[model samples]
Target: MLARTTDPIVAIATASGRGAVGIVRVSGARLAPLISVICGRSLKPREASYLPFRDAGGEAIDHGLAIHFPAPHSYTGEDVLELQAHGGPVVLQLLLARCLEAAVESDASTGQPRLPGLRVAQPGEFSQRAFLNGKIDLAQAEAIADLIDASTEAAARSAGRSLSGAFSQEIHTLRDALIHLRMLVEATLDFPEEEIDFLQKADAEGQLATLQAQLGAVQQRARQGALLREGIKVVIAGQPNAGKSSLLNALAGAELAIVSPIPGTTRDVVSQTIQIQGVPLHVVDTAGLRESTDLVEQIGVARAWGQIEGADAVLFLHDLTRSAGTDYAQADADILRLLSEKLPAGVPVLDLWSKQDAAPSTGPVTGMSLSAKTGFGIEALRQRLLEVAGWQAVPEGVYLARARHVQALSRVGEHLILAAEHLAARAQSLDLLAEELRLAQNALNEITGEFGADDLLGVIFSRFCIGK
Candidate 1:
């Protein structure tokens, strides 16, 4: 049930526009009275009744289906009522207005004042209320957002798994192990006068080692999930006419970038979001890298460098036909030098051998024989991309995650590593251990918003759409 002091809230819980039907969702103690006023009769709990919803002027806004879910079992764990009417924007607005007008009558069946009057629901208020009432946790709530914004089918499936608590279960399992270790350590510390050397004990070291290894595995899996959810930005960079655009077109399965034999055809970065095996691949095709006397080409070269520096992954295209196999020594040296100097450190680089169809079957580099026109070696390229992204083919309940979640998990990993180091050093640093534990707990808390109060709740919920 909702807090007795709070009023019922109402909003249309469907996408805006013309549809077959639209739903007006209302929740709180005031729902029943409002329903009665609009329906002109009492509604049985969880029963669908065909009814004419009336406006203040005694006019039918739209005849529709009405259902009521009494408190403690509803979506928001309160008295909930839904009005399904014609999906026309005007009709839906009128139905919503009628509900608002009925808010003035906040009486129970016996005419006793229950809570307060009804108010308009905020964007994510319904889901927020569900979280507050223990219907769903913080991770599942975020998964709802991720599901709504999923860019690829794989991302959507992963998000669905997350909403079903796949990600939460993993986190809980790791947390349980950590909690058990922490408890044992703390229990030993409780009896400081005991002759037992807690840090030096064989059992303590063994447990710590196990916990560290388990934490490491979880961290790796979390990184992969993060990559799947957040995706990678790949930038194509090389000298002019290096077949960069051809590679982009091949990956995108569409002519996303203009293909021209002319150098500097692409004067600005062209970007596209493509889904490869359900993972979003943000590919940026930039103008070929080179010093140019033309002003526009100069600006383009600067932008290309910027893209290369900022990308999560870079593709260095080396046209084998242009290199003629013999002069490739200088080309290879220049390519590696530019890759090291211009691209960001730690960003993955694909040493792409372009025009592979024309290149000799044998080459010094372990280059893939890719024919953008024939779609050869495309699967190999995709696998390579996935490998660089730390993604796996395993379907073990992967979940959608955000940058915030990734950063939080990283902090937890860091603290856990530090804790292991301190314990191994035989340092009686309970204060440091406690501080790290507190930090790790806070990181997990951010994912579920368990530690924050009402103010933070308002900020988090305000980002959702009116429906959910």
Candidate 2:
């Protein structure tokens, strides 16, 4: 998307609906004349005034609270005007149209239009402007979107922390440390004739060690934050009457999926999102995995495998009540064999023995047994899923992060590792070490948008809702 920074932009800031109030926001270099044309009076900077939003015909379009924020103090670092009117779609649209119309109208004495080429703001354009104007970094800008789309309270809290500059501050601290190290390395290169070793005198190795440790800490937190932001997808697969539906309902704490004694009850993927200890788990209850002659049942079994292939984790549920039957045991063995051979590599599989209430002590079972009816072993199952997901308890100062942030941190670690390897070679590898350090710094810089491409910015902001 083309970013027109100079042109004034307007948008309905609040969600579209009939509510108690709605807001039409406008931002530009100088909005006093436009404000006067729209509000029919000069608005004091950073003050709210109850006034009639008028049209060019001198008729009141709507009565609303008008607030003016002068340039360098507003959200986009430009003069801003907000019209808080009655929350009606028609009213907000009318107010927005008036704002645009007033932008092109000339002042009685100045003859020039107050805002030339005023237009509607694009999706995420407001936040993009805030980033470009140095009001917030790229990380904080992303946090704004994350905060809006957060699925769990923990995710929202983490996003809030990132927006408050906690995540960016940590990145800046790491960058500052890297810059200091670079200065010492560059100084040593500049003074080649000096007998004294500058790096050794400054204990550069010690500093690098500390920096690596700090990066590790940041990476750990970023991983957890990413988990909170993008929760794990789990697919449940098992033979008929294995309590897969019951397990899903138990996890969700609601009867989201139908449960009965009949086979093939779930003919499609039944999905639900439930939070466990602030981590969202997207559970998909698939049709029973079995060899069926029925056409629809076969299709469902195929679909079940399809879901399993894309899942982050799979629950290979087994029926403990059917353990004594010879055919049931053989069928369970066959399913286990298929799972071992057909399941995708790297996707963790949890062997769950369901219906513990009926067979309380099934002998020599490999996986955990639980009664979905009685909530027996459900807590252990929840804890195991979290472990399988590599999720730890949300630590203090934890902030929301995205997959890209984790990838960037991983790249930084890779570069640092190469730098340490080069530093080990001492005299011959100082130049290589410095280069590695520079690369590492660049990777970290991308996280905060200190070094990023225009296209990356476009893609990031394009995902945001209009009016940010």
Candidate 3:
């Protein structure tokens, strides 16, 4: 990508399939010559002209609409041409090939190639070019892909906000505030004799406090936005015939897992995604946990433990009907002990009493009771799941954000904390305070591509679909 940023490129811009229309797009430093060759005439800037897309022999390959965008006013900040042709696989392929052929055809006037170095575009190269040329920043470029791949309406809307620079604007505001404080600290550092007096008069402590408060607010929203993009993973584990599979089927509204009276029916994990208030929940139903002599059941139990350990949350289902027996109580206690031993700290484990419709009226009452067969307590269970996920459903609505954004903000907060501590130290650590503030600003710049590594940029753009 770094090697070919200057080269002219072309691609089939629309998704692969039959539709009413398909577009073949080209971007380069100069496309007027290539446009004249393929389009057969000089196109009016930014205007669509209906004409025959001709082959080298002057025969019509397809009739299409040709639109031209002059340099510096296009998606990639380059001269661009788009051919809107009939949506047919064969026809589009022919048009795509014709573009390559026409680009290399010698000009009649100069005996030179019509457009040198025209090649097929790499996945996301177009958007990468836009970023490189200042048409958009890194966050907005990522939002383009997020919007396209969004699984829910809320996710899509949030991606649109990020693409429109809402998230970037917030980052910029934080950066500006950080810069002001850094300026104050660095100015005071230049004169050690009056450093203490300088900061006090400039209200550096108050400024840093305000910055931290603003950062806390941004971090809260960014966390919520990230949850919308990357939802929580939930694992359901319990003894056999506890209705774990039934509960899964109920939650997903489909029979994704097998339901049988046999104790070891579920021998592997079954997964589904359900949305609560447009926040996705990736739920996994694991095989029943128990001591089993059978080799297959042992393996299933082991796999269930594996899933349980990695989950963001666990739903430990209990068989209420078996609550009266001492042996059953011992088994429940054993499972609970293992859960505590294997699961990470702070990972919530919600104990649920299954088969509520069949349980005897007398037993220890604990946890939420629900019968998957009758759909009892399912709504409350869903709301509980949302709470475990830490979703706030912000009133202003969330803008789509990635895990990296959350991590970056966390790092910024860390730096600010150190900056404040160093600031309070006064003349003893003015240099340290300035350094932390500069580091914080760099983290902020990373989200906008104002400061970043090349490999990071490559990894980012590579995730995009081709011809974006």
Candidate 4:
């Protein structure tokens, strides 16, 4: 990423499919000769011109509008050309082929290639170019991808905020404060005689405390944003005919899973993603946990255990109609024992009473009582799920963040804590304190992508779609 690529790149900028319009984009240095040759005439810069696109042999392939964007003002900060043509599979392929052919064609007068080293763009190369060319920061470049892959309205809006530099601004603010503190510490280091008095007078401890407070606020918002991006997995576990599938259908508002009165009906795992208050919850309906004679049912039971072991949260359903039975109660207790042993530490398990309408007395239940048939207690269940997922409504809005961001912030907090300890020791650990502060700033830099390992950058950009 440090080295800039001079080679021209071309790609089908529009998504693959038949539509009313498709765009083929090209970016490089001095694309006028290629544009002139392909469009059959020179294009007016920054303006769309209706024209016919021809092959190298001067055969008309299609008619479209072409726009030219000069360097330092375009998406990639390079000379960019966009050809808008009818959006058909063949039409776009032809247009893309023509761009490649025209790039290497020699001019009669100059006897040299019009645009040498022209090739198809790799996935995310366009956005990476924008980042490298100073058109956008690394955080904004990532925001473009996040915005495209967002699954919900809240996630999309948050990504838009990040793309607009909301997240980066906060990181910059933290970095600026750290830099100022580092200046004071480094200056004190130069003159050890005045170090302790200078730090005390300047209220270094107070400044560090204020910075930690700001960081805590940002961490809260960032964790919320990360939750909005990667939602928690919720698994339903219970004996057969406990209305587990029915509850899932009700939550999804669709009959996605087959519901039957017979036991052992669902012999496999069925999953559906449902959104609760703009935060996605991947609700999984696993095969009922039980001791069954059937081979298929045994496999399903095994898989159910597998899902439960890895789940972020588990919904333990009990059949309300069968609650008074001694055998049923004992079986539920046994299953609960196994559930606790299999689950990881800190994984939440919420008990739910199913078939409330079918129960004779409708007596008070120990857990959340709901009737999927009558839609009773569904809203309350949703709120409880939100609580389990750790979602808090941020009225000020959030920026879409990833797991890496949360981890980086945690590291920053750790470094700051170490710095505070060193600072308390006064002159004895001043150098150590300065080093800790420097490391904390680097951690902050990683969040905004000011500096990071190149391999991490590769993994991130490689996930983007081609022509982005």
The lDDT per prediction is: 0.77, 0.90, 0.90, 0.89
User: What is the TM-score of candidate 4?
Assistant: 0.96
Clash tally, candidates in order: 0, 0, 0, 0
Candidate 4 ranges beyond 4 A from true positions: 1-4, 360-365
Candidate 2 stretches greater than 4 Å from native: 342-344
Per residue, candidate 1 scores C-alpha lDDT tens digits across 1-468 of 123326678889989999999999988874656676788888988999998998876678889999999888888888888999989989888887777776764455666533346667877888888888887877788788778877777778878988998877777776776666666667656767886676556476677677667656666666666777778998988878878888899998999888888988999999988776777778999987766799999999888888888888887777777766555547556767877987667887877777767765745265555767677777788888878777775566567777767777888878877876766655467657756666666776776666656766676677788967
- Give the per-residue lDDT digits (tens) of candidate 3, residues 168-203: 999999999998888877778777675367789988
lDDT of 3: 0.90
User: Which 10 consecutive residues of model 2 have the lowest summed lDDT?
Assistant: 359-368
> lDDT score of model 4?
0.89
